[model samples]
Structure formats: C-alpha cells, structure tokens
Target: MAQVHLLANRKGGVGKSLISLNMGAVCADTAGARPDGRPSVAVASADPQGTSLWRAARLADQPFDVLDISGDVANVALLKSLPYDHIWVDTPGWAEITPEEYAAGKDPLGDEKYGTLLSALLDQADDVVVPILTEPDSFEPTWQTIEWVLKPRNVPFVVVINNWPPAEGIAYVEGTRAFCEGHGWPVARTVIRRYRVHTNATKVVTQYHNNRVELQAREDFFRFALEHGMRTAAAKEVVS
Candidate 1:
C-alpha cells in the first residue's frame, strides 16, 4: 500500500500545489536514500482547478506520476492498492458552489460539486501536510481545516509555515510557534521561505543544486519532506 501524504488547507495560496510537486519529487529523487529504494511516487490532484497538474505538465521531465483525480472516485478508492511508496495529494482550499448555496452557508471542507472527491482523498490520506502563511488571515482557516478535517478522523499532521520572508519574519516565525504551542498544533520546524526559483520552477529541486540559490531553494522542502516521510513511517508502525 502506498503511504499518502495530503497537502491540504481551507485557504488557497498557501503553497499546497508547490509543496505537492516538490515533496513528491523530493521523495522520488532521493531514490535509495531509504532502505527500500524509496520505490515510486505519485502526485494526485484532487482540486477542481488542477493547479498542480497544470504546473507539472511544464516540467521537462516528470519524476513521478501526476494523476488528475479531481472527480475520479474509482482511482481514489484504490489509491492504497497502488504500487507507489508515496502518493502526494494536492487538495482544494476552496469549494465550488452556487450563490444560493453560499448564502445558505458553505461547507468548510467542500461543497457538493467537489465534496465527494475531497472526502475520498481524505479517507485515503495517511497524513496531511498543512501549509499556511504567518499572516493573521491564514490562521483561522488553518485552525478550522485541522479541526474539521483532520482531528475528527484522528489523522496525524504537521503544520508547515510556508512563504516566509526570511529577511523580516523572525518575530513572525517565533510568534507562529507561540501561536501553535498555545493551540497545541503539531508544527514542522522547517519554514519554507519565499523564493523566485520556487515561483518559477521548471525542474525538480535536485536538478538545480549546482547553484547556491537553487540549493537553498530546495533545502527547505528537502528537510520537511524527509521529516514527513519519517513521520509517515512512524505512524504506520504505530498503527501496525
């Protein structure tokens, strides 16, 4: 069975797609870094927008399978039976709904138009990698996201602070930690700083290690992905 890592959030623009692509690729690129040769990786996009799928198409060489399972129930139900070691799912932050439905009150997880797909993916997830910015607006949705989707299911997760500007985010980063600690949120030590290379990635991070800036760009995800992989393994062991 593949160990699935879902990059999820209730707020968009938190770097879910970017993390999906990099995390999956990083796990794939490391190949023999793990004892079992790390095997295969598949990134499935569960969002209706398919941002990850669209962006992955532009990569010169795809290191892993990118499945568009936005509305594919059969495939999602069978994800665990797939032959990959890891499968990263990029989920939607926003749901599709009519104005009437919106007025009625939206589902924090999703709406009828996209709810089923999200539910299926969530069911198969071994763990969720929740990305969020340090800004105040990103906090509430993140809290709602974990409380609504993860806690009920008892899914283990790591809250990764993304898009951090290293130059001036020291206090903000520390404050995020304080905030997470106050609320008992499981947070990743890694902070993915904003980078031009990330905003315009054409290849996997490993492919850009020749340059200093690029290495730094890949460093953040490398650490976080490794941490995530270890957590997945540990979680499975406990389950066993």
Candidate 2:
C-alpha cells in the first residue's frame, strides 16, 4: 500500500500546491522503479481549482502520474489501489467542517461536498504536511487547522515555513521556529527561501535539482523531505 501524504492548510496562498508538486517530483526522481515496475510516486489533487493537474499537463514529459480526484468519490477510492510507493494528495485551501458543524448542517465552508472529500482524505492519510507563510496573518489559521482538524485526529504532521525572505536575517527565522517549538509543534529546520525559480515553477518543468541556481532550494526541500520521513532509505543513499 502507498503512504498517502496530504498537503493541507486552512490558510490560502501558503504554497501548498508548490510544495506538493516539488515533493512529488523529488519522490518520483529518487525512488526509482517499484518491484512491479510501476511509477514510484503519484499525485492526486482534490483542490477544486485543479492547479496541480494543470501544471502537470504543461510539463513536456510528466515525471509521475497526476490525477484529478476533486470531489469524486470513486476516484478517491481508487487511491488505495494505486501501485506506487508514495502518493501525495493536494487538498483545498479551506479548513474542513467539524463533525459538530456537519451534524448541525452549518456547513461553514458552504459545501458538504468539499468537507466530505477532505474528511475522507484526512482519514486515509498516513501523514500531513502543513505549509505556512512567515507572516503574522498566516499564524492563526495555521495553528487553528493543526489544533482543530489535524491534532484532533491524531495525525502526524510537520510545519514548513514557505517563501521565507533571505534578507530577513536569522533572528526572524529563529523566532518563528522558537514559537512553534514553544507550542510543542514539530517544525522543519529547512526553510524554503523566496526565489523566482519557485514562482516560475508552474510555467515550466524544472525540478528542484535541475538548475545550479536552484541548488539551495533543492537542498532545503531535500532536507525537509528527509527530516519529515517522506524519503525512503534508497533515496537518502542517492542524496548522500
């Protein structure tokens, strides 16, 4: 069975899709062929916007299979049967409705369809990756999702600070890390810095390890995957 990873956060514009694609690329690139000769990595997008699917389509040669399983009960069910080592699911940018809300029919997100799909994904996921921005505005919703949704389900998770500005100095980065640690949250030591390479990723088929200029970004993501248990021993051996 594939280990399902959900890239999720209630906060919008937190780089969830970007991180999902990059990590999927890394898994596809490093994991090699499976015992059955199937691809090692696959990506399933549950986002209504289908951004990941669109990006995958634009690539000249897709490294791995990308599936648009948004709001489809049958497609979501098909995830368990996929013959891959790692399966990454990209979820929408809203917090899932609580059971209380669902029972009460409050439907805070305005649709039971989305909440149901998200709930199913969370239930099936082996690990969750919460991408958060460095700004103060992103802090509240990030913690809220972790506390209200992920923690309640006892899901294992790690917070990655995305789009960190290089000029902000070590003090800013350390402060964010300290804050998360103080709250007893696991935070990735590797911070993905702001770069044009990442911003332009959607328009091209560049992997993190492809260009010399993207070496730092590549290392950051590679370390993040290793620390978060996303990479296999064989992948780590190749990196080392």
lDDT of 2 by residue, 161-222 (tens): 88898888877778777777887988877898887877764432235446666777677777
Clash tally for model 1: 0
TM-scores, all candidates, are: 0.88, 0.84
- For all predictions, the C-alpha RMSD in Å is 3.7, 4.9
Which 10 consecutive residues of model 1 have the lowest summed lDDT? Answer: 30-39
Candidate 1 lDDT by residue in tens digits, 41-159: 88888888889998899898788888888878767879998878788999887643444654677655564656767777888888889898889888877877887668878888989
Model 1 regions more than 4 Å off: 32-39, 95-107
Give the per-residue Cα lDDT of candidate 2 at 58.
67
As for model 2, its CA RMSD to the true structure in angstroms is 4.9
* Highest-scoring model, lDDT: 1
